[model samples]
Target: MSLLVCESFLSIQGESSFAGRPCAFVRLTGCNLRCRWCDTTYAQEGGGTARSLDDVVAEVRASGLRLAEITGGEPLLQAETPELAARLAGLGLTVLVETNGSLDISVLPPEAVAIVDMKGPSSGEAERMDLANLARLRARDEVKFVLAGRADYQHMRELLPRIDTARNTVNVSPLFGALAPAELAAWMLADRLDARLNLQLHKLIWPPDARGV
Candidate 1:
């Protein structure tokens, strides 16, 4: 089957526990929700280029990186995503699938780590998030919260108890240029929150607007 692919490239993983690692990225197109601070607005529409699953896998293999991430507009929006994840895993690569926490992550292969972006109140799409996915998280899976301000941070704090951090990794990411990292860090430290402070390393390494990093 063919997938609607936006662009594929090699870069350092900028989020999750795998951050700072060399990785290949397969960015699919078309997101179901539109967050106010969404960075990849370009990938949300236009139905991107269609590529066969095998072709996509070959690109990652040729990258020579052992890490691969299937991200999107919303990767789960495509039907063949699980098969693609399975194929990449079959290649002996550590595959990570980043989803916008609106769909059932159970559809992803067990070999693929699921990085579920849990929308906060500031995103305006928080209501679209499927709380059920929190219970569905696998040990290798991760949950991320991108906060735009204190309201978002508060919202994330309310949901933390529902997630089992001992089993899954929880990431608290401040929306680039929207929230101060130090302020968020102070809040987390004061609360003794059991989550990692994840920053978009690519944006720091390069221009925030630069694509194909």
Candidate 2:
């Protein structure tokens, strides 16, 4: 099956533990949710190149990168994403799928590390997270929360007791320009929250508005 791919390129990873590493990315098109703070709104539209699964995998292979990511407009929105993920992993690349926690992630290959972004209070889509997927989270998976304010941080505090933070990497980041990382860090220290502070390294290196970074 062919996938509607928004963009694909090899660039330095700007987020997660793999930040600063060169990675190939396949940005698929389409999304079901409209998160207010979405950065890749351009991906939500229908205009994109239609690439077959094999073709997409070929691109990654040609890049000669050890790391590759399938991002979105919610990559899982397309039925072929799991197959694309498996093929990428089959090539010995460390496959990462940057996903919103609203779809069924079990479809992805076990070799791919799933970075599930769990919506926080200010995203307006917090309730849309699929609890079933959250329950299936393994230690290999990562969960992220982009906090927008003190209210979001408080909500995260309430959510911590329900999660197995020791088994997985819990990532928290400020909502880009809405809040400061230092504020979130201070709150984490005061509450003794077990989480790693996440920053958009790509945004720091390039203008936040830059594309294909």
Candidate 3:
């Protein structure tokens, strides 16, 4: 099976626990949720290259980056995502999937690290997050929240104790340009929220609107 891919490129992993690491990114097309502050609105639709699983894996293998991230406009929208993720993992690379947390990740391969985008208030899609996915997490899985303001941060803080804090990596990222990274850091320092703050490392290295890494 193949996927409608927005673009596949090599860049430093920008979010989650893998920030700043060299990684290959496979950004698929289409999403089920439309968050108001979504940064990748371009990925929401339009032209994409439809590539077979072999071709996708070949592209990642050619990048010379051992860490690969399968991101979206919700990659799970593509039914064959599990196969693609498993294929990438089979190639001896550390495969990570950045998902919108609304899908059933229980079927994802064990070798793939799942990064659930746990939407907080700022993202209009907050209510869509399937809380059950939290129970499916393994030590390799991570839950990330992109905060646009104080309300979003506080909402995430309220959710911490209920999450699988021991087995899961809870990451809190201030919406790249929406919230002041320093301010978010200070809040984390004050309340002692046990979540890792993520910055868009790729945006720091290149234009936020630029594509193809």
Candidate 4:
């Protein structure tokens, strides 16, 4: 089977607990939701190569990286994603699938580390998030909330207590250029929220717009 691949390249993981790690990223094409602050809007459509699973795996291996991330416009929208994840894992690469939390996370390979993007109020797609994904999250998995301001932070704050975070990691990232990092840091500190504050490390290390890093 083949996957509609937007772009595949090696770069430092920009967010989540795995940030700063060298990773091979497979950015898939198309998305069902439109968020106002989306940085990868170009990935929405019209710019992808239909690649066979074997070709995708070969490119990841050629990157000389052990960690491979299947990201998107929305990876789960592709039916072959689970097979792709299993194939990469079969090759001994740790697979991380970054998905917007609108689909079923349980459908992915059990060995694949899922990074679920839980949309916050400012994203406009917050209501579209599938809350059930939080229940499927495991110790190796992560749930991220990108906050745009105090209201979004407060919304996430309230949403946290209902989530069983004992097994999974929680990541709170301030929307780039929209929310100040220090502001979010201070809010988390005062609230004593048990979540990691993640910066888009790749953006800091390289220009934010630079692709295929």
Candidate 5:
């Protein structure tokens, strides 16, 4: 099977809990929602080089890294994504999938770790989140919230306790340049929130607009 792709390159893991680790990125094309603070709006299109499963695997493997992240404008938009993820896992590579929580993720392969991004109201696209996906998550999966300000943070803080954190890991990241990390950290400390803080390590290392790793 083939899939649309935006760009594929080897770079440091920028977000989530695995920040700063070397990773092979398969940035698939297209997204279902348009968030206000979206950094990768470039991925909102559906056209890109169409590569077969083997071709994609070869490109990732050639990077000489055993870690690959199948990220997207929203990867689950592609029907073959589960197959692609399984293929990558079959190669013994540690595979991680970054997905918007608005899609059904239950179809993905067992070995692939899911980094599910749960949209908050500040994103202006929170209603799209598929709440059912939360029930399907395993211990290898994680849920993330990207906060833009105090309102978003407060909303998420109230929602966190209702979520089953033991079934999956949870992460909270402030939108870069939109929210102060130190201030958000202080609030988290004060509330004694169980979530971990995440920073975009790649933006710290590379220019924000740069592509192709």
Candidate 6:
């Protein structure tokens, strides 16, 4: 079977707990939610390129990177995504699937880490998030909240109790350029939230809008 792929490259992972690690990325095309401050909107539509699972796995293998990420648009939008993640994991690669949290993440292979995004109020599509995914998180899985302001932070705080942070890594990523990292850090510190502040390292290493690493 083939997957609709947008682009794939090897670069430092820019988000999640795996940030800064050299990772091969497989960005699939299409998304169900339209977050207001969405980056990579270019992958939100279009058929992208149809690539066989073997071809995609071969490319990641050639990257010579031990870590690989299946990102989007919204990676889960494609039916073949879990298969891709499983394929990567079969190769003994540390696989991560970056999903928008609007879909059920339980479908991914246990070996593949899930970096699930929990849309906050500012994303405008927060209501679309599948709250059931909170209970489905695995120990190696991560849940991220991209906050734009105090309102979003509050939303995250309220939802924290529902998530088993002790089992899964919780990440709070302030919307780049929109909310100051220090501001979000202060809020987290004040509340003693059990979540790490995740920054987009790629934006710091290269131009904020540059693609393909």
For residues 20-132, what per-residue lDDT tens digits would candidate 3 score against the true structure? 78999999999999989887888988778899999999989998888999998999889989999999899899999999989989879999999999898888888998988
Instruction: Write down the TM-score of every candidate.
Output: 0.99, 0.96, 0.96, 0.97, 0.95, 0.98
Model 1 bad stretches (over 4 Å):
none
Candidate 3 TM-score over all chains jointly: 0.96
- Model 6, position 16, has a per-residue lDDT of 87
lDDT string for model 1 (96-190, tens) is 99999999999998999999999998889999999999999998999999999999988998999899999899998989999999999999999
lDDT of 2 at 120: 80
- Every model's Cα RMSD, please? 0.7, 1.1, 1.2, 1.0, 1.3, 0.8
Best by lDDT: 1
Measured with C-alpha atoms, the lDDT of residue 144 in candidate 1 is: 93
* Candidate 6 lDDT (Cα, 0 to 1): 0.92
Q: Per-residue CA lDDT of candidate 4, range 1-213, in tens?
A: 899999988888999988999999999999988998998888888789999999998888888899999999999999999999998999899899999999999999898999999988888999999988877887799889999999899888877975667777889998888889999999989988899999989888988888776
> Across residues 96-152, which tens digit of lDDT does each residue of candidate 5 receive?
999998998898999999999988898998888887787788778888888999988
lDDT against the true structure, per candidate, is 0.94, 0.88, 0.88, 0.90, 0.87, 0.92
Candidate 1's displacement at residue 21, Å, is 0.2
lDDT of 3 at 91: 89
Candidate 1 TM-score over all chains jointly: 0.99
Q: Candidate 1 clash total?
A: 0
Q: lDDT tens string, model 2, 80-198?
A: 99899888888888888999999988988888899988888788988998867767776688888888999888877777766788887888888889998888888889988889898
Candidate 5 — what's its lDDT? Answer: 0.87
